[model samples]
Target: MRRIEKNSLGAALMMALLCSCSGRTTSEPFVQSVSLTRPIALNRETSHLYSGIVKAAHEVSLGFKTAGQIARIHVSEGDYVQQGQLLAELDDADYQLAVDALQIQYDQLKDEVERTKQLFNQKSVSANDFEKASAGLRQLGVQLQANRNKLDYTKLYAPTNGYIQTVNFSPAEMVDAGTALFTLLDVSRLEVEVSIPANEYLRRDQFTGFTCRAAGLKNGVQLRLGSITPKADGNQLYHLTLAFAGQPDRRLTAGMNVEVGITVADTTRTGGFGVPPGAVFLDGEVPCVWVFGADSTIERRPVALREMDNEGRVVVIDGLTGGERIVRAGVSALEEGEKVRVVETPSQTNAGGLL
Candidate 1:
């Protein structure tokens, strides 16, 4: 009976040993399907940001110099006019009649003065009589000149070349002296006025490379800084003036709201690897990137990021060395030290080429 017991114990021991070996050998590798790329080096990435519209520089208001009843309106709102061009005509009939009357009186006074002078020269009239005739001529001439000016004022002319924005008085409307006849905008040159907060002005050099964009500019257009106003606004906003690179099309007009972006600085670093924005996942507050090893093993490494560019790529600032294989796609489904099959997509190949 003792011999039988020993044989049973030996069999049990052999079975247990085989089971342990099988357990160790049958365990599968943690296979994770992913895409990978080398980590980019610094000095190979650029930073980009966005901002709002800047208006053109020069603007003026056109007002009537003299008061009169509007007889005709020569131009309407949005009409372009040249300097000294007639903008409107008042009730010039009365003014013309007054001028005509003054001309007639002046002519008569001149004739009388000429006759008086002749008489005085021939001793047919006293010096006092000749002086009276001369004085009458001078007084009439002054009055006639005043009347002529009133007539000329009846016509409204543009002070400068610009687009007419507002026409306050319509035909037959009584406009008073110095009334606003038109609001002209000089769009020949436009200025983009932006108010940068005090904090932004601290880096005064950042204002150098900004671009201004309106509704239609998707590709982005460049803007040049015209001036930085020294004084702040009521809210302590520093006003910045940016001039357009070239004359914008007529479609761009004054008072049109736009988006502007000031280039803070050139942060294009070299040898830095970029990944699709989707691939960047946060492990707590720390930025962590996944890299695939040569044997399809995944390793999670911390990375420093500088800024995101306009192209939707995140810049790998540091904590990553160049030419290190990193998981480019399917980063969200990765675990530390997991075995991954690096599936090279067309985009992934292109990204590899870029580095």
Candidate 2:
């Protein structure tokens, strides 16, 4: 019986040894694949594009100088007008009649003054009577001149050559003095207005080289830096005025939208890499980036994010050297030293371009 028990124990030990050998020989590390991109050197020329609108260099809202009932409107919205062109007419009957009455009164006074001066020369009139006649003529002359001005005010004329953007009132409508009657735009020159974030206000020196391209145009227009608002707007942005480097096309008018591209360089900064904002994920409140190694494996690398551009991309200031391949997405649920495969897709790159 003791001999049988010994044999069974030996058989059990041999089976256990065989199982261990098979396990050791068949086990191999599994490989996992993921999408990856190379870290772009932050020193490379970077571009920031902003959407802007084309504006007239000079715009004016024309207002009526005097209040009256509109009798006629000679120009329509979008009409081109020259300097001193009559744009509208108010009722001038009252003013014209006043001028005629003033003319009659001035003529009578002049006759009386002439008669009084002759009598004074003949020593047949008193000095006071002659003086009274002379003063009456002078007062009538001034009154007549004032009436003439009132008649002229009945007509609204263009102060400058421009295109009428809009006419606010119709014929027969009563308008008040100093009320806007038309909106005129001087399209002789054009400008682009772009609002940039308050934080990214470019110094006047930085704008020496900037380009703007309007929609439906083939080439870019050189920008002559205009003015930067000293104050922030309601949206916490600053307004930048830029004019075309050369003569702007007449077709490009106010209110048209355009894209302004500004290329900037920062030599003061160094040792940085550019990556998509989404590519970075927080690992326990610390910013981290998953770097892919040449061995088809990924390792979690902590990154020091420096500054973020207006384009939503974060600048990695530390923990990453340029040219290291990194996982662009799906970094939230990844392990250290995880094997990953790099896949190329058309949209995969476009997705990253948003940054």
Candidate 3:
């Protein structure tokens, strides 16, 4: 009976100790491990890329000043031409005949004027008769010049160095005066055209720099502000024209599509902080982030967002200042004012935090 009592008491003490240990384990506070990072200083310069198109600075329409039948076309569409090169010619038979007729009359009147001038000097003719002869000679000379100009107008010449975009008339085709016979695309300079929204148009003066990228141009090209429309179009978008800083590559041509990047100074975004996108969460409708405090506890803080950067980081314009430690990863499972343990970043020599 004594031995049985002693064994039963020992077993009861063991059970009490086991129950105490389990209770202590259950009552311990839970602390979540999380990665933390300090907010980065936001850059005051912001860059945005937009779609643009290459266009020739000057597009000209070639036409004849006088109406006539097309005698021949010296060049075809897509041909490159230099300044003063003859592009086409009209049938000059009728124009030549008119000039010839005027020249004959002009010559005859000139000889008559000289004879009258000598006779007047010799006191054989009246001053009025000499003046009349001289006047007739001058009138005939003016007529001759007018016909010569018409003969010259029958031929069309390139006004500038350009590429022929269109040839509307062919040989033996009759065309009216001032009708566009050819479309010339002046390739001496190029311009890039892009449409921007109203917000950007309002801050057009804040633009700092511009660049463009096109097919076959790996290094890209720099551009300068050429002009911007003062008023918005029907779509409420403003048109911006950009010119090349230097001579552009020869491969770039009119109507080709390109990508334009514009950089602007963000004066309104002063005192902003850049944080990882994963660190930002939503508190109801408002954007919130988990800010780890000095006491090793995280609280949900609302932040006013500006815009995302090129590296996919969220820019917080208000609420959180720089040098604040925020949870960088695994923020969804966290609760308000929850105690947390910061996991140290691994060293370069000891990756994966194994060491």
- Which scores higher on lDDT, 1 or 3? 3
lDDT of 2 by residue, 34-96 (tens): 677777776545567899998878888887777889999999988999999999999999989
Model 2: worst 10 consecutive residues (lDDT sum) = 199-208
Per-model CA lDDT versus the true structure = 0.75, 0.82, 0.92
Comparison by lDDT, 2 against 3, better one = 3
How well is each residue in 1-355 modelled by candidate 3, as lDDT tens digits?
9999999999999999999999999999888999999889877888888999999999999999999999989999999999999999999999999999999888888888988999999999999999988888888888899999999999999999999999988899999999999999999989999999998888798999999999788987999999999999999999999999999988999999999999999775565888999999887889999999999999999999977765678889898878789999898999998999999878899888776
TM-score, per-candidate, Cα-based: 0.59, 0.60, 0.74
* Model 1, runs deviating above 4 Å: 1-51, 54-59, 78-85, 112-143, 160-163, 218-220, 229-236, 266-355
Q: After superposing candidate 2, which stretches have Cα over 4 Å from the reference?
A: 1-47, 119-132, 202-205, 263-355
> What local lDDT does model 3 show for residue 77?
93
The C-alpha local distance difference test score for the whole of candidate 1 amounts to 0.75
Greater-TM-score candidate between 2 and 3: 3
